[model samples]
Structure formats: C-alpha cells, structure tokens
Target: MQAECPRQPPFNCSCTLDNVVWDTSRLYLIPIITVDCSGLGLTELPGVLPSNTTSLLVKENQISDLRPLVNNEHYRHVADIFLDDNLVESVAVLEGSPWLFNFRVFSLRGNRLSQLPTYALDNALERNRHVVDIFLGNNPWQCDCLFTPSFQVNTEEG
Candidate 1:
C-alpha cells in the first residue's frame, strides 16, 4: 500500500510512514513519520512540519537559525533531528525548550558552531541522560575555560 504523506506546505521533500515495533509488552505496530528535506540548499528550516513527524532530516542545508524548531508546535513530537553540515552557529534558541528535553537523537555534525549555550544542553542531557544522543562532531569548537567545565561535566557523566 502507498503511504500518504502528511499535509504540509510545499517543500522539496519526502515523507514516509513506516511501521515500527513499539513496546515489547504491547507488541503493536506504530506508524513512525519521517520527513526528509536534506540537501535542498535552503537557508532556513521549513515553516511547518507534520504534527506526527518523529524524525526530521535536514542535512547539508544553509540553515542558520533554530528558532523555528523551538517555536513551531509541529516539532513537539519530533524525537530525532539530523542537521549536519548546516550553517547553525548557536543553539541558544533551544534553551528551556520542551522538545530538546524530550529529544532522543539530535545531530549537529559539521555545523558552523563555535560556542554552545552550556546550560541548555547540560540540562537536556541531564534530563534524558540514557536516551538522548547529541552529536557535535566536526564543528570548530572554542574550548575555553567557560566552555570546558560544562563540556567536561557532560562528558564525564555521559
């Protein structure tokens, strides 16, 4: 059967509803919605996403701001977000964001980030220590004294 893509604004992307096994006790199939908008040469995230989107892939784009991700209600259920090779410089927008606290996998690999808002990231990691995996590889990080302590704490605890 053909999967119906969720209703959203026009963007050069594709969506899939894959049957995934949820809890072992329940033994039921759940449709996991994944939206792929990678390598589209976009300067920012799409204005809206499907409400049921669980995974979002927007790698190799020119997106610099993360405000949309934090402000948009459509991203509330998203768990995994791949933003590798984007132009994102700061993650301060995610501070105290509910989605960040519940995220399972957040990849920012190969971005233009030099410094991080430690409190936001630290809190998110602390809250979801076992489940969340945040990738910060390939960024030009400034490991100053201010950035070191929190980074050390997360590294030691994680």
Candidate 2:
C-alpha cells in the first residue's frame, strides 16, 4: 500500500493545476492500508481521517507536533508511523495521550529531537512491552544519568 512519486511528482498531482490542491486543507482518505505523502507542500496533517486507517506513511512533510492528531479516532490504531524528515523539534505533543502507547514502530530520523521522550514510554501499558523499532539517528539523544540502564534495556538496544 506504500505509495511514492511515480514520475514528476508528488505523483497524483498535476503541474498544470499549479499545485493548488496541495494548498487546501482537507483529509486525504483511501481504503488502502498504507499511504505515502512525501515531497508535498504539506505543513500539517489534514483535519480529518477514516477510522480504518492504520499505517500513515508521511515521511517528508512540514508536520511537527502530534497533539492535533490525538483527536482522530483512528489515532489509537496507528502502529507503524513513518514521520521522518519533518520539523518536529520535540516529542512533547505526544504526551497526555493514552493511545500512542500501543505504537510498535515510530521513526523520527531527521527531526530536532534532543532526547527520546521517555515520559510517555514510561507510562505505556505495562503489559505492552511490544514497542520494537525506534529510529532516533539524526537527533541529539540526551544520554544522562537520569536515563538509567534499565530504560535502555527495557526498550530496544538503541
């Protein structure tokens, strides 16, 4: 279900329209299980979604905070989220939400995150230790005493 730019893209878009559709704010819904919206003029996610959506493949966009996405009914079911190459500076917006804990793969490869936000991870479902892959490669991880050895071992071997 992963989609990419076919030829001269943002593939589904047309250069003839002067890319006007990219400016409008609306939900891009499809019955597919995966979607890729990279290299678009998107600064934020569209305001709505279909509840059946699972994997949202938004690798390169202008999105930063995840707070706004909390209200989406399908937000809880998102397990594989590809959110690399964005403007996300901090993971604070992910806090105060209960649904984000079930996430199994969260990729933040090219953002401005200084440290992996452990606050939300600590509060995750205790029985749900299934969070497997986390990509924090390009960010500055704050490796400090507060980041005990237990935290490292509990999750993946970052």
Candidate 3:
C-alpha cells in the first residue's frame, strides 16, 4: 500500500498508517517534509518511512544503530540529526549513511562511546564532511590509544 502527499489545500497534509503505537504514526500527514522522531521511546525506526524526508530527529531513544536510515535516498538531504541521548557506542554507524555527507548540526550527548570513533571517518565521508557542532558530552571520555588521542570535544552553548 502507498500514499501520496497531495499538493493542495483542504487535504494537503494527509497521511496513512498501519497500527503503529507510541507516537510512531503521527508524523505522516504533515507536509513539513522534515520529521524529528526524538525522545519517543522508540526502540527502532519504523520500516516504512517517508521517502522525501529532509531531516529526522531520533534522539533520546534506545537506538543503537542508525544504519537503518541510510538506505533511503532522502537520507542524504537530511541537514540535522539529533542523537543526543541513547545507547550509541560509535559514530561508525554513519558508515551506513553515505547521504550524510555534509550535516549542518549533529548531537550525541549521552551514550556509551568512550571516545570519538575516528575509525569511522574514513574516505568518501571525510571528503565533504562539514558539521558545525557534534555534541559528545555525557559519554565515557577515555583518553587512550584506541581512539583519537587529539580529539578534543567542545560543548559551548550555541
């Protein structure tokens, strides 16, 4: 089953769903195109997501792998992704999402990551990467030989 987002009034912002609980089916009909699915207690992302989505917010959930969102064509255009509080252990998950070429802002405040996963910043992704801020506070900051020893995390208010 497929539903098209109409381009007219009176029915411009309309959506369809199939028995999704826990605020999962709420962002469908809104014509905003950008949806933030953060802080909703979502263990994982819904299998069926809007193809035209430009921004996705899946912060403060139980998500450990953001690789699921990399498959869609719209994932590249996503300007901002908030993963401030979750069980994420590595930004290596970005490896799965190539469309994440030039993210304007990113947040991974609370997670299990001991240090920034410099291993994840390999080729292709390191070329056009331009993130203004990447919040890595509240995680296990271990200054060891495993991660980037020179990687200094900044947490200034913006």
Candidate 4:
C-alpha cells in the first residue's frame, strides 16, 4: 500500500503524524530541519518518516526497540538521531543497516541498554570513524572487555 504524507505546513518541509513532526526545512534552503518528537510518551516508533529528514529527535519516550527504522525507506537520509531517556535496551535491530555508516551523531544517553553487538559497533566505527558521534552514557552498561574495546570514550562532557 502507498503511504500518505502527513499534515504539515505548506512549506513542503515537514510532515506531521499523530502530533509528531518530521522536519524537512533543509530542503527549502532554510536552517537544518530536525524532526523533534521528544517527550511524547510514545511506546512505539512512528510508522513513517520523511526521507529528507536529517536529524531525528525522539527522546524521552517509551520506545524499546529500533527495528522499525530498517523497515522503511526514510532511514537512509538520516544523519543524526537522538533517542535519549527512552526504554531502548537492544540496538541489534541496526546490525545490517547501512545507515550506520553515514551517521554523524547517535545519542542514547539515558536508556535501558546494557550491551551492544560487537560486530555492528566495530563496523560502524570503522566506516564512519571520524564523523560519527555516539553517546551512550547513563545506561546500565556492562563494562566488560568485549564492550570496552570497540567504542571510544569522550572524557569531557557537554
């Protein structure tokens, strides 16, 4: 079935779904458009995201898994994502997702994550070494040899 575009401003730069807005202003020569759906108390990832979305902000929700991103085409253009303060425990959903290679930032500062898939982390870090900024602090992280070796730590805080 064909997906319908959500209601948004006539600027053709945003799509709204169930009170969630997917910003696409970057396509109109405006400031970088970032889809901000934070603090919505949502339990599942939204079904649709515009392919033009550059930054996705879905923090402070109840989302547990990220597999839905792989099921849609919108994930390809995403450069950054903010999923902090959620219920995410496993990111194995993103194992073979090509989007990891081009990500500029991925924040999961406050979640339920205790472990990450090693091979996925290694592949993402190696391919996008100088560009990706991954944040995984304040979670129930199991500090072990397997987890420690793949990721780099930032000593300073923002």
TM-score each candidate. Answer: 0.83, 0.65, 0.63, 0.72
Which ten contiguous residues of candidate 4 have the minimum total lDDT? 1-10
- List the candidates ranked by lDDT, beginning with the highest: 1, 4, 2, 3
lDDT (Cα, tens digit) per residue for candidate 2, span 12-101: 321111111222356553343444556675666544433444556667788887775577665666676778888888776777665566
Model 3 Cα shift for residue 70 (angstroms): 3.0
Cα-based lDDT at residue 82, candidate 4: 89
The whole-model C-alpha lDDT of candidate 3 against the native structure comes to 0.58
Q: Which stretches of candidate 2 lie over 4 Å from their true place?
A: 1-32, 125-130, 142-158
User: For candidate 1, which ten residues in a row score worst on lDDT?
Assistant: 1-10
lDDT of 3 by residue, 43-125 (tens): 66544446545455667788787676577454556566677788888766576355556676677788888866554544423
Query: lDDT of each structure?
Result: 0.80, 0.60, 0.58, 0.69
Candidate 4: stretches off by over 4 Å = 1-32, 149-158
Q: lDDT of model 4 at residue 141?
A: 81
Model number with the top TM-score: 1
Could you tell me how far off, in angstroms, the CA of residue 141 lies in candidate 2 after the best superposition? 3.0
**Higher-ranked by lDDT: 2 or 4:** 4
Error of 2 at 103 (Å): 1.7
lDDT of 4 by residue, 67-152 (tens): 76666676677678889999999898887777777778889989999988878876777677545478888999887887665543
Best-matching candidate per lDDT: 1
Candidate 1 per-residue lDDT over residues 14-52, each given as its tens digit: 887765657678886666778888888878777666646
Whose lDDT is higher: candidate 1's or candidate 4's? 1
Which is better, 1 or 4, measured by TM-score? 1
